[model samples]
Target: MEKLYQVALTMVEGVGSIMFRQLINNFGSAENVFKAKTDKLLKTPGVGKQIAEGLKNKNLFAEAEKLLNEVEKQQVKLFFSTDKDYPSRLKSLYDAPSILYYKGKADINSVRTIGIVGTRQATDYGKQITEEIVAQLKPYNICVISGLAYGIDIAAHKAALDNNIPTIGVMASGLDIVYPAQHQKYAEQMLEHGGILSESPLGMKPIRNLFIARNRIIAGLSDIVIVIESAAKGGAMVTAEFANNYHHEVFAVPGSLTNKYSEGCNKLIKDNKANIFTSVNDIIESMNWDTEGKVPEKNTTRNTEIDLSQYTQEEGQVIAFLRTNGETQIDTLSWQTQIPVNRLASLLLNLEFQGIIKALAGKKFGLKL
Candidate 1:
């Protein structure tokens, strides 16, 4: 019943991630949000009368119920934002999807993840480099991520399959439909070790804006993003931009400047937006990753119970919020704690310096795991 309301809330005409957060915060749950009076809904921040009225539509629930049935029939998994299994790296971003539809066997929250993106019109050199990069990364036990398109995207996925590396494809279409249908074979093969994921609803077709939106997930899911080849204005460059904004480490292979596909990579390097990707060593050094083929142990030293009396009231408030909400953007912390952004920024820096909390991509902060 809760899952049904969760899906129904997403079907509301104007309810997006931010609004969904606001509703959940105010109502304490999606089911409550749906049952709230129109007057109450109108008072919630950013929930205009129009959106509030849209929540009253009974058809949304019927639609959501149908989708849920389809998902169950197809063996698709739904990851809500509050789910423990949701991707931790993406959960802190302001615009991450409220729900994700996933299929296949790979762990989306793997210990280490890398996103590989490039132009669909990849050259042989680009394809070879992508393959080599995946192969080299095998020993580190990386989960490869890409859009699962043609050219370098497919090459990376295929390489991961060959290397027995878990690879996830963030798709523009629904999980039931694979765009560029020729890659359906590879998509099926991925189910053995990797998987395909999407935020779009079942039966949704690939569209231009959706592809652009899908790039953010690729950027958000990765600890690092590597652009293999791209023209000045293409999907790969867009993904790189999203990565930079998210504060994820970005790397671009230096390609021949004369090649049109290399223009984006060179420009990214020139602008100091991405590091030059020469070898696997670049990623190892940048991320300080271990190459010994061992998974790092979780930090069990941090006690779950904290003595709030040891900290100032404001600091205690921030800690309490983070304790309840895993990773959160600084702006959200400010809004929730009623602290000015400037003051919160300094306070967060102090906490980070004290090793009480760590900064993450997109200006988010979380207690050290």
Candidate 2:
């Protein structure tokens, strides 16, 4: 159906995320874009003749159908940008993947998410720090995100599992193919609480460029990214750069001056790109998270009854979404309610004043508990 066309459009030659967005905007759906005439395709912005002709290839649909069938068989969940379950944080980014493949139990859109990245050549100190940070974060019940590489990435995933925290690993390879192969057991174990995700299609191999590209998803999914230990240049640094670009808070754990792995974290601190990560208190305070023993129940039904008729339709729309989805960022609220952010901000402010909702860290709003 429409999902098949969506996968096919992404498979089309030279159809990157930006172009995909432009085409979807112009045609209103991927199905329409594929059905359009070559001349019409050429008329769309940035659609060069080569791309226009590529859309006419009948083989793309067949390939997409084949991939979709395999995806269903593997029990992997596919998320196009427009899908309801697509990660909202990534949706706001201009260059995020238009399609994602996920397999696991954890919600990718968990209310609290953190990214932990570092050099593949992690030292004993680095691994210990990664494990400790994750352990302390258990009470917060946050989803930990990382690229499923060696060193700090694996340490973070293993620690999360030990603490029974939901974690997500963004992989460079297809969901069915676990790179490094050594971590396959950990990857499988993650399925019990966390899961693996990838933008690569069913049979895509993990290439050099894709690994670099995967860092952005790690950055985009997090409210804050922690660089445990990294060299001056590595995938972790690239992830930090993406996190900075996305305006998400970045924290770097300081290390011994002589250690090569500390260079990236030090440079990030020197360049004023990240905060100094000392302990769990830094995260708790920076993110404005409660210091209580356990995270309170969220999105639970309220015992008190309140009439929706008292508010304007737009306000009701916002309230309805929050009631259904729990804490929501302002951007997602705007998208779901079809209200402009500026106007929605005012509505949220009104609701906050009336004690109908409360604002959390990161511009999220939830019904008053």
Which segments of candidate 1 are over 4 A away from where they belong? Answer: 302-369
Q: Which one is best on lDDT? A: 2
- Write candidate 1's Cα lDDT for 166-206 as tens digits: 99999999998899899999999998889999999889999
**Lowest-scoring 10 consecutive residues by lDDT in candidate 1?**
295-304
As a whole number from 0 to 100, the lDDT of residue 185 in candidate 2 is: 92
Q: Please list the Cα RMSD from the true structure of every candidate, rounded to 1 decimal place.
A: 4.0, 4.0
- lDDT of each structure? 0.88, 0.89
Q: Which number leads on TM-score? A: 1
